[model samples]
Target: MGRTKPPRLDGESEDDYYMRLIQKLANEKLALFARYQMEQQQEEEERKEVATNLLSLKKSKKSSLKRKQRDFDEDDVIDIKIKNKKKKKVGVTTTNKAEQRPVVVNKVTEGVKEFIKNKMKGSDLKLLIQKTLYASDLNPGQNRLNMPANQLETNANDFLTADEMRKLTDKDKKSGLEVDKDKKSGVEVGILGPNLRMYDRMLELKIWDMPCTKNYVLISNWYNFVKEHYNFLKKGTLIQVWAFRLNEQLCLALVCPDHEDDNVAFEENLHDGENDDVAVAASASEV
Candidate 1:
């Protein structure tokens, strides 16, 4: 007969015995390996789906940024074209205005100058030209002491006589010398000489000639005269001043720079002296 089958445990059926043996065998080996493999495959599939979604999101962001940049570039191009057109319009308007503006000319000044040129006499015109040239050549703070030759040669008697002055002083009468006197007080004309100085718009001149002795004249009048001939008034220049005392103060009635020809001669003499000195020095050096 065949080998006898193993006996079952107490109270165990034949099917229960086979099922327990199989469960014990599976526990000893790999019982749930197929189930673990199926779970890993599911996790891999979820990771691939997440990666694909992230890639699509990145592509959409890039495309949106490119579209925004393209719109901005088009707007910039339109703005640049509009500005260029406006500038061209403004330039055309300015050019038309400049072309329409009229030119102006002065005729009165030219006519007046021509009239003066025609009216002036020969000797008078020559003298005037000389004076104008001299004045033009003079720098500020420098002066030319030039007077009419006739005025310089006038005798002291012609200017004022003692007898005439006495008559004018006592009687307040007009003299032959045209010495102006105040009618209220009969005063003789006095003379102001060289060494004149201006102080605070007041001219103070020392009196050395005529009847006055050791006196100084503070001239308050003749502002216009002084202003007109200001360039001629120089220090150490001979100024023949016709003045009279009013309230014990000398009032300058008339004044003029005199002896200009003599001053010119003196300057020439000085220049010659300087030349002589230079010649002597040169000769001495040669020796």
Candidate 2:
């Protein structure tokens, strides 16, 4: 038989003692959980505040710039003052996604210059390219993606509808590739061939840098997505990509697996399952 210890005199009852201990532990755990919830609430409030503050700030900055421009039509000195004001770092400027730019074109000869170059063949093609260049929406100096409604042309109102270089007859070749056009649908489609350098060049300019995995979507501001080359799904195709950087400079890209090929490999494995089982049995015998 096990020996029982004697109870202490002047001590609390056993049930009372254990209940107190249980309550103490419960209190501590509750305190911890309360602290976690408080922290989460505070973080959410802070994020909301930041987003609101940034939107208002960007609006103010734009208004201020417009006023200055209006007042001084030709005063270089006033312009210099405004420039200096921006240059003076007053901490993070109020910013917004409304004016967020995807890419700059004028600084890079506008995105559709290749189409313009092709217009030189005889004067007829030249006129078409000329109208496209002059008649289309003029990009805001600040953002190539922006096109005021008035600037859009009759034939090609949206940049998406116009300037589909991929659709130009293969009979006249600037770039060598076959484009599958849908006659019934009146739309063009295909995966974009990889232009690996596009991302690297942006990085070189310190424009953007980010890594994409899963479905890395490049929402081009000015490219014709309808006729985009989807050949990345081909057996062994490759291309470069681009992204915006955290710091206005140092944009970069990396080589990543194409999801299209992953699908192909999965199907191939299914077909080879029988062969794999036979090989496994032979290996088991050898062991």
Candidate 3:
């Protein structure tokens, strides 16, 4: 008999090894389940808080004297930037001539709207957007989460209430032409309510909160004209996310004003200009 002794039980019985593995797997699964439950509970608590904050926001009447300085200065010029490079040569305008107008477009996936109805917040939204952009591999650029500058502003507008809408839109009603009959190829708009009534509140908000004053009413027209009706949603804005998310939400915050900054106008007349080129191309295509 070798002094090696009762020899380590030879080898672990295959069944015994399998039983131990099964136990380990069960414990891991239970831990994961517990973690998920905890996360859900935490999100529910956050949602409750978001709802309370938005509902509690109220505008108290006050006497006003000094008006807030708008982000854009008196000499600032607004310029239109068509996303397409080809259009840039032809459609993008640099000069303040031609009476530029702003256009607004708003569309939400049926799936997304459904998600909001249930309750959501900035953190949850951050996850949802991450899941989306990750799959697309698209970076919205310096704006939060690499989103388009305009889209950044649009997302922030999700915070607007009905009264806000009315206040915002009023200015456009006063400033823009009614255009009961749309021109063949002119500015088109989709807005919150069917009637023009909602714009007053929208005007007030934009004129104040949005930071640009010298830029024509195009921004206002775009925001107000595109909504069916504004609903209040309390989420950190693209700006808020930029400052808070350590710039992770960069895509959500970057916004392009419909036009260039006040200092550099695109030089609409520098060349014979592309407006003529667009007209020629469009005519040729129609033909």
Candidate 4:
């Protein structure tokens, strides 16, 4: 061998052994630094390659844009000729008439009209609001029915007289003017149930005008009306509210299309003078 090797030590406490161990660790550190430098150099090369490729792609895009512009100019000449031909044929092209579909009349809505005419003897009946009820409408604590201005089937002004409309839109509330109960900025309208029977009391229809939103809400006796018709006035239930004049008093009919059968039966009972039980129940609800 190249010079006799040192005798092996039982433990690594010998000076030669300690020197060898230190040399091995130093070599490992040097190898790690070499690998780190290689990785950094490789990354720099990759970055330069990517930059050069991007520049080449940008130049290619510029050339393509010029080519497209030339093609577009040629196409514009062709498009002008095509437009001239289309104009010549414009008068000869006959338009197809839209197919007319059969109008489907809702039976429940027709029934409501009949009820107003026969039972209530009401006139000027019109669909006021058609909307699906939400939790706010059925909430007991709220004790009111909200009808957004936009949800009205027709113009809101159509439903009220000039004086009534003026009262509702008046800004006197901010002036702290004392308003009489009869002169309050609301119309007291009687509420009819889905069965076409009026509630014991009337509900006040008022405009709730705020800075960002406005609504026509029914207050005062709304809680009793909801409690009486709780089963049919749940959330998500679609209802049509019809406004009419009964004996010169403003009245509304609440109709549920799904409960048309019940309404038919109630109407029959009323005609046969056999609705005494319903009348008694209605009186009890007042209490």
The residue-by-residue lDDT of candidate 4 on 1-287, one tens digit each, is 46344565787667878698678669657645533443343334334434544455556665535553434333454345345544643212111112111222477678668766765456888887776576667656556676656456668767677876766666555786534322347877877788656677868887754222346778888878888887788877778788877656667778877665556554664465344433533343343
TM-score winner between 1 and 2, please give it. 2
Runs of candidate 3 with Cα error greater than 4 angstroms are 1-11, 59-287
Q: Tens-digit lDDT track for model 2 on 120-197?
A: 111111111111111111222111111112221212222222333222222224554432211111222111122222
Query: lDDT per residue, candidate 3, 52-117, as tens digits?
Result: 333443223243534477533212311112122224342222222222123222222222222222
Model 4 has an lDDT value of 0.60
Q: What TM-scores do the predictions have?
A: 0.17, 0.20, 0.18, 0.54
The better-scoring model by lDDT among 1 and 3 is 1
Ranking by lDDT: 4, 1, 2, 3
At residue 177, candidate 3 shows an lDDT of 42
| Count of backbone clashes, every candidate in sequence | 0, 19, 56, 0
Minimum summed lDDT over a 10-residue window in model 1 is located at 121-130
lDDT of 2: 0.27
Please report how far candidate 4 places residue 191 from its true position, in Å: 1.4
The CA lDDT of each predicted structure is 0.31, 0.27, 0.26, 0.60
In the range 1-287, model 1's lDDT, one tens digit per residue, is 97345567999998998887777558534423422432343234324434544455556675536553434333353355345534653112111122221222123222222222332100111111011112211223221122222222233244334653454334424553423222112322221211121112334331211111111222223233335445654433233323233223322222222433333432343234233332322232232
3 or 4: which has the higher lDDT?
A: 4
Model 4 stretches with alpha carbons more than 4 Å out: 1-105, 173-184, 261-287
Error of 2 at 174 (Å): 80
> Could you tell me the lDDT of residue 124 within candidate 1?
13
